[model samples]
Structures are given as C-alpha cells and as structure tokens.
Target: MKIFGHRGYALRYPENTLVSFQAAVDAGADGIETDVHLTRDGVLVLTHDEEISRVSSGHGLCKDMTYEELLALDFGSWKDPRFTGERIPTLDQLLDLLEDTSLILNLEVKMGFPYYPGIEEKLLEKIRARNFLSRIIFSSFNHYSVAKIKALEPAALVAPLYMEALYEPYHYAETFGAGAIHPQAGLVEKSIVDACHEKNIAVNLWTVNRTEDALKAQDLGVDAIITDCPLELITALRS
Candidate 1:
C-alpha cells in the first residue's frame, strides 16, 4: 500500500506548510495530502479549517481574508516556536514546489460548511495548466464537488470522502466514475475494502497515525494509507 502524508507529516511540523511538505518528502512519504481554500482575492491556499484561527494567529474566515491579509498571520507559531515564520502557501506555489516530484498530490477541496462558488473551475484550471491531471486526486466531503471535478475533466481522478458509511459506496464511486473512496480510517473494515476492491475501486483511508492501524490497513489490502506522521509510519512499514 502507498503511504501519503496527512497534511505533510503533521505530527512533527505545522500541517499544510511548505516546511511540513518538505519534511514529508525527506522522510520518504510517497505523497502529501492537503486541504485547499480560495482566499478573498481568489488565490487558492492550503489550510484545513474554514477559519484561520485554528492554524494561524489570524481570526477570520479564509474566504473573507485576502491573500495579502493572510500572509501577515503566523501560520506555524501555533504549532511551535521554531516554526514561527512559516506562512500559508498558495496552491500555485505548492504545485510549483512539487511539480518535479513523483509524489501524488491529494487535494481535499474544503467545501464543507462554507461553499465557494466556481472553486471547482479554478482548481481545475490550475491543475490543467500544471499538467498534473494524471498525478493529483481531488477529494471532498461534498459528493457533488467530487462529481463536479469528474465532470470538469474526464481524465481527472476523484475520491469522495465520507465520515459515515454510505449505502453501497463502491457502487457510488462507480456511478460517479471515481477512482477511489476515501473513508475515515476508523470507519474502514475488511468487508468494505473487499467490496471496494471487487469493483476495482481503490480505498484510501484517512488520518491514521497509529502504526498498528497502518499495518492493519495494509494487511486489509487497501490502496493507500493517509497519516499525520508519515515519517514514523514509513519507518514502521519498512521495519
């Protein structure tokens, strides 16, 4: 199974920052997963929450803040003093950074809670320009967003994320032409994995940090495992 960094070895570095992503690459993660939000100035930025308060020194919805306004916030200090200078990175910046690597880019469109109109088009445009359609996986809690992505680009890969089990999820993926299903790590089971595999739908579990859990998912024959500590998981898997 492939191992992806959940927000870039998130346990050791600030999640979704450039340094964190570099750490993931240095630690030998196969890929790095990140969340995306469109700033008020129409710049796509990496961040998990709709609000900047959780990850940075700023207090406002990301959609309400311009990219310039967000640059002033200290995105890393909330996690550690040494990482105090880490700033939020635009998606363009991140793509430029990783364009040369073989690392898979899993972009979780942050459409839950607050929806951004035309974000699908914006994201699609950038990925197409970067010619990353083959390497990137677009995932979201909104199934409609997942559908939109597939509709936008026939060659684009999409995985719908779910916290709760859906009725016949493998079929759901097939109906939407999704390449994979991203379910919560705790929500995964051998039966679901089996069902998904039978339909040739890859199962990528999310937010798993424990070594035992990663091993279990591997034994279950899931396609990939997403974790906050890719460094530790990579070492554990190798050992």
Candidate 2:
C-alpha cells in the first residue's frame, strides 16, 4: 500500500508548512495529503482550517485575510522555536517543491463553512497552468465539489471524503465518476474494500497512525494509508 503523509509529517513539524511537507518527502512517503484554502486575494494556500488561530499567530478566518496579511503571521512558531519563521506556503510553492518528486498530492479542497467562491475552477486553473494536473487527487467532504472537479476535468482523479459510514460507498463514489473513496479509518471493513476493488475503485483511509490500524488497512488491501507519522509507520510496517 502507498503511504501518504498527512499534512506532510505533521506529527513532527508544523502542519501544512513547507518544512513538514519536505520532511515527509525525506521520510520516504509515496504521497502527501494536505488541505487547501483560498485567501481573500484568491491565492490558494496550504492550511487545514478556515481559522488560522489554531496553527498560526494570526487570529481570523483565512478567507478574510489577503495573502499579504497572512504572510506577516508566524505559522511555525506555535509548533516550535526552530520553526518560528515558517510562513504559510502557497499551492505554487508546494507544486514547485514536488516537481522533481514522484509523489501524488491529495489536495483536499476546504469548502464547508466560509466557502470560497469559484474555488474549484481556480484550483484547476492553477494546476493546469503548472501542468501538474495528472499527479493530483482532488478530494473533499463536500461531494458536490468532487462532482464539480470531475465535471471540470473528466480525467481528474476525484475522491469523496466522508466521516460517516455510507452504505455501499463504492456505488456512491461511482455515481459521481470518482476513481477513489477516502473514508475514515475506523469505518472501513474488509467487505467495503472488496466491494470497492470489485468495482475498480481505490480505497484510501485517513489518519491511520496506529500500528494495528495500519496492519488492518494492509490486510484489507487498501490502496493507500494516510498518516501523520509516515517515518514511524513506514519503519513499523517494514519490520
């Protein structure tokens, strides 16, 4: 199974920062999973929440702040003194960093509350401009967004992320032309995996940091496991 670092080695470095993503690459992750939000200026930035106060020194909704306003806040200092100056990274910055690597990017479009208008089109436009559309997997809890992505680019690898257990999720994903399904790790069963595989859909579970959970995912024939500690999980799984 492919191992994807959740928010880039988030267990070690500040989540969604460039350092964390690079650390995930150095730790030998096959892919990187991150959240994306649009700034007030329409710049796509890598951050997990609409509110920046949790991860940075700034206090406010990310959508309310311009890219220039966000640059002034210390995104890394809250995590550690060593990462004090780590600024919030843009989608362009991340794509540039991953240009030479064969890592798939699971870009989760953050669009629930405080939604950004026309985010799907903007994101697709940026990826197409960068010529990086083939390596991205667009996912979101909003199934509409996933459908929008597939409609925008028929070849785009779109996945619907759901925390609740859906009845026959493979069918749900298929209805929207999704190639993959990202469900909470605890909600996955062997039957679900089998059903998904039978329909030629990939199953990628999230936040699987425990060894037992990782082992279970491997046994169930999952396509990928997203975890916060990639290095530790890689070592444990190999051993």
Candidate 3:
C-alpha cells in the first residue's frame, strides 16, 4: 500500500506545518495528508481543528479570525518548546514548497460543528489556483461536501471518510460518485476492501500507526495507508 503522511508527519514536527510536510517527503512518503479551513478573509490555511487552542498559542475559533490574525498565532509551541515561533502555513506556501516534488497530496476537509460556510468553494478555488487539482485528492467525513464537489466538478477525486463498519459501502461510494473510500483502519475488513476494488474505488485507511497494521493493509493490497509517524511507517515498510 502507498504510505501517506497524516497531517504532514505530525509526530516529528508541528502538525500541518510546511516543515512537517517537507520532513515527510524527506522520509520517503509517497504522499502527504493535511486539513484545511477557510479564514474569515476567505483564504485557505492548513490546520486540523476548528479551535486554535489545542495546537497553537492562539485561542478561539479559526473561522472567527482573519487570515492575518491567524497567521500571527504561534502554532508550534504547543507541540514542543524548540519550535516556539512556527506559524500556520497557507495552502499556497505548502504547494510552493512541494512544487518540485512528485509526491501526491491528500487534503482532508474537517467537518466543523456547523460546517464552515463557503469552505468548499474556497478549497476548490485554492486547488484550482495552484493547478493542483490533478495532484490532490479531497477527503472528508461530510457526505454533503463530497456531493457538492462532485456536483461542481465531476472530474475531481472526492473520497468520503467512514469510521463505522457499514453494510453497503459500495452503495455509498456510488452515491457520492467518489473516486475512493477512506475508512478508519479498524473499520476496514477484507470484504470492504474487496468491495471497493470491485467498484473500481481505491481504498485508503486513516491514522494507521502500527507496523503490523501497515503490513496487514499492504498484504491485503490496500491502495493507500494514512499515518502520523511516516518516518517509522516508511522505514518499517521498506524493511
């Protein structure tokens, strides 16, 4: 299975930062995964939570802050003291940093409490702006977001993330017109993996941290594996 760094090699660096992303690439990840949210000014920024408190020195909702204000917050200190001044990165900055690399990108859109308004459009625009539509795949737990993207651009690769075991994943995949299905690793059974393949939909499992799980997925012929410790996972997979 293709090993993708979840939140840009989160274990080694501040999650979702450009530095972490580059670290994942340096460690030989096939791709990188990250979360995106729209600022009050409509610019797309790389982050994982609706609130900034947990990951950054800033407090309050990310949606409430302007891009400039969000940019001013220290995002790295919470992870480690050595990374004291790291700030949240813009989508453009990330793309620029990865411009010369051939690694694929998996951008996960977080499903906020009420869902961020116009976030779908803003995200699509950013991808188009970078001309990264082909290199990136959009993944989300929100079926509405996937449907909206499919409605606007049928060619876009939209993957719906599922956490619980479902009776008919293929039906749902077909319903969303998705290119793939990304289920939480534990929820994925061999049958589900086979079902997705039967429908020609790729299967990617999220947050896989154990070498045993990675090897299991690889043995099962899963298309991709999402993980936080990309360095370890890649090393283990290689060995």
Tens-digit lDDT track of model 2 for 1-239: 99999999999999999999999999999999999999999999999989999999989998999999999999998989999989999999999999999999999999899888899999999999999899999999988998998998998999999999899999899998999999999888899999999998999999899989999999999999999999999999986
Q: Looking at candidate 2, what is the lDDT of residue 67?
A: 97
Better model by lDDT: candidate 2 vs candidate 3: 2
**Best candidate (score: TM-score):** 2
TM-scores, all candidates, are: 0.97, 0.98, 0.96
How do the residues 38-139 of candidate 3 rate in per-residue lDDT, one tens digit apiece?
Answer: 777878889998888999988988778998998888999888899888999988988997788988898888764746887778778777888888888888
Q: Which stretches of candidate 1 lie over 4 Å from their true place?
A: none
lDDT (tens digit, per residue) of candidate 1 on 1-239: 99999998799899999999999999898988999999988999999999889999989999999999999999999999999989999998888878889999999999977889999999999998889888999999998998999998988889999999788889889998998999998776788889988888999999888999998999888899999999898899997
Overlapping backbone residue pairs in candidate 1 total 0
**Candidate lDDT values, in order:** 0.91, 0.94, 0.87
Full candidate order by lDDT, most accurate first: 2, 1, 3
The true-versus-predicted C-alpha distance at residue 176 of model 3, in Å, is 1.8
Candidate 3 clash pair list: none
Off by over 4 Å in 3: none
* lDDT: worst 10-residue window of model 2: 184-193
